[model samples]
Target: MRRLGSALLAVSMFAGCGGLETEPSPESLTSPSFESQQAPITTTDVDVAPECKGIITFVNTATFQTLDAYLPSNVVTNLVNRRATAPFTSLADVSSVSLVGETRLKQLEQGARARGAINSTCVGIFDGLALSTSDAAAIVSLVNTIDDSELHDVLPDAWNGAANLLNLRPFTSAQAISNVAGIGEVSFRNIRNAATLSRPFEALAAAVNAIPSNGSAGVQLKRHFDWWNEVTAQHGYSQGGPTCFGLEPSSVPYGATIRPYLANSAEVMAEVQSTLDYVDADTKISPNVIAAGMANLSARTQGRSFKGCIFSYADDPWSRHNVAIFVDTVNGFSVFSETWWAE
Candidate 1:
């Protein structure tokens, strides 16, 4: 096994003499590029309380008579006059009306609950398990269409995630929702379960049976690669080697073939070692190469803590290449490592 310093030096020397081909600019392995890609995904800073279904209708759409059911006559009259100018935009606005306060708000909430307009459970998650597929689908639908304020009120801890979802609106699949920052498996599951209790989400849920599962591992790996390519292009790094290889995208030889495979951490480690041994046998490369590669990979990954995949590719048969992509399914933290041998 070689130290990273020596391995990197060897790679550079070999590359300069045309004796080996490897990823360029190992320092680029840091996550700045990935972080930069997040800029366009969240464009909003507005923060307002969400409007629950029953509360929204009560304040913005209910008749005077309907208002009378939940409030004193004087308060109803006040609310009616207020609505004549403009419909309330949020629960806070409703609360601000003359003669309405915490007690009145509670009345409204209770009334809505009694009439099936809202569910108490919608405000929080009580279950620890993942939501059912239908439940998850319902939440995804709500997240896709709900305004940022509403989402904020519904999922208070997910303010940043909600903003991201707003920019990446109309999420057609669960995987897309899960990929958003600040939304992890637990949060998603909570949202799903909580959404099942809300009238609006329930209505939408009726039409959706399940949120689409992220495709197989191979599909996900390809998606990650495609995302990297897109990001590199957008950031004006298209002329550089592939980011997966810690180099600009342009470093990938034209027509180089990439094949992705689903693998456990153990499988990925095994393949890495095998590739290193094969290369060493063929070219007598540095004894530390395998150690350096393994160290690089381990440092970048979370071992069994996340899902992993392997991509094997070659610009030509004489060269061996592998990239391991790891995704923290819980939080959507994705990272990759590239190891290659070239003649």
Candidate 2:
């Protein structure tokens, strides 16, 4: 088995030969070229007891008759701005509104659970990723035990390998919610059925929609791989990414790219794989033509496909973040994506 380091060394040498005319830093790369529309992210933390009295119920939290005094004024205003006439079905829907992220949603959940009469409001949804047994069990128990909240047969099917995903925390991103190791098409259908059963939880459907099914290409593939050839992806997606690698792009290919490392090892691998892909795609280019990319050894080694990497990090949500797109032979994804913390 060739170590990951050997692959990195192979790719690094390719990058050194005039890959970039300019290097990107956090500052330079702040405005992302390929991200979705921009929204302000403000984190507001609210503490609530498990049981308490609150005015707005989470199941239909959009119509908070009286905003909690505890909620920051800006948050209340933000909610009001997003809500039109219909009451909010769940916190997840509220999150769809601009500027509402995980922090504000949690604050609302905590307060609503304490004060509102509706107890079945779902706080989080899981896609089909791994989960620890206990966490999986907790969700399973919630589904089975709830009256209209019945997850019933759905949870068990999704729980096939709950033990593997426990520490992974796959629920964090839209792309992360997949049936990779835990849930499957059956479980997904089960959940969808439960939602249609006129369950008490209005949020279940939205959470269900978050998962990808029907043999859809994985969601994160676009972020890292679309621009796998940073040389082309650097131009921006709307501008048209490279359709072909030209068998072998030049040794000192003009417009070929050498990007600064994005943030962590997980991100670097995406770029590495992109580089390797270009080399492998063209008969003229040899693996020996690759180079060390990004900042350091850890950054370059992150893309080693020998590790059996299968996915890339969920594209960073914050618009200020940077992305590196390059090509490689095998797909490179990160195991630590579950543990990645935004600085």
Candidate 3:
């Protein structure tokens, strides 16, 4: 079993005895443009004491609207009121606010760190990466589930220690990898780096795995759409309003620069139409309504360019009814469409 390269087309059917399916022709589905579209990632070194001056500053100085994006409104209100009378002096002081638990504290810390507010060191090898909780979780999942061969492929330099990782199955945390024999700091760093680079494919696989093998097309499509929203939201992508006629906006970060690649709107819509035709073979939804919905989606995003791919699951008989559209806009937001029909 070779690694599914950048344009991973490996399909996993949800039916009995799942096996890899053949790649669809390029004309049908656009592969992810990870290799070309990925930008250079820069990280800062944080070698300091336990004091989290950055987190304290962010909580005290950031505006309420900015704070609201990273925290619950109630927690934000409590933090604001608490900080107003007396600014938080330490992480403990921030935690003392009502509704601020360990998890919430981590969220705040990560959010602050992402905004360059945290200059001090934190726990975990992934701390400096400023990863969202979801991205960290995704990396953790990749490490726990990836086999030795795949691990070696991703971290060729760490191949000698790959066996140690496989033997120590089900790593409870990303940090737990450090405990493995032969997995030194460099190996751990490489593994985490690889995991981060592979997040897009991991996200796609996770979304596909979420769909039920035996369900109405409507149900499965909705499942994939929901999973996409949840995962993207965890990565700081904002969601727009609910789906309008099986078409909804994809989650994308505010003020993000949209880089159009892989395919244009016309190509994406064609692939989408092809997927809908496959679904219509067995679904009760009329072709006319599907066309109208697609037209609406087109009209909504007209003249706007996108850079992403459409994953069509029409190869596997059981999963053929599902399709995933992941496209990005100039605003650094991803737009998604959820095509559905009543069963």
Across 167-250, the per-residue lDDT of candidate 2 in tens digits comes to 354353322434446655345334333322222112221222243433412112121111222332233332222222212332
lDDT of 3 by residue, 1-343 (tens): 2221112112221121111122122222122421222122211111111223345455666667767789989988888777657656544456678898756776777766666653333332232233333434555776787544346544545555777777777877655665676776455555554544433323333343354433445333220122233322322222221121111224332333333334456755565555445444225454454444555446534565554323322323333322344333332113343433323
Model 2 Cα shift for residue 91 (angstroms):
3.7
Q: lDDT value for candidate 3?
A: 0.44
Q: What TM-score would every model get versus the actual structure?
A: 0.26, 0.24, 0.30
Best of the candidates, lDDT = 3
Clash counts per candidate, in order, are: 12, 39, 5
Judge candidate 2 at residue 132 and give its lDDT.
23
Q: Which stretches of candidate 2 lie above 4 Å from their native place?
A: 1-66, 120-343
Least accurate 10 contiguous residues by lDDT in model 2: 5-14
Tell me the TM-score of model 3.
Answer: 0.30
Using lDDT as the yardstick, the better of models 1 and 2 is 1
Ordered by TM-score, highest first, the candidates read: 3, 1, 2
* Residue 240 displacement (Å), model 1: 16
Q: What is the TM-score of candidate 1?
A: 0.26
For all candidates in order, the CA lDDT equals: 0.42, 0.31, 0.44
Error of 3 at 74 (Å): 44
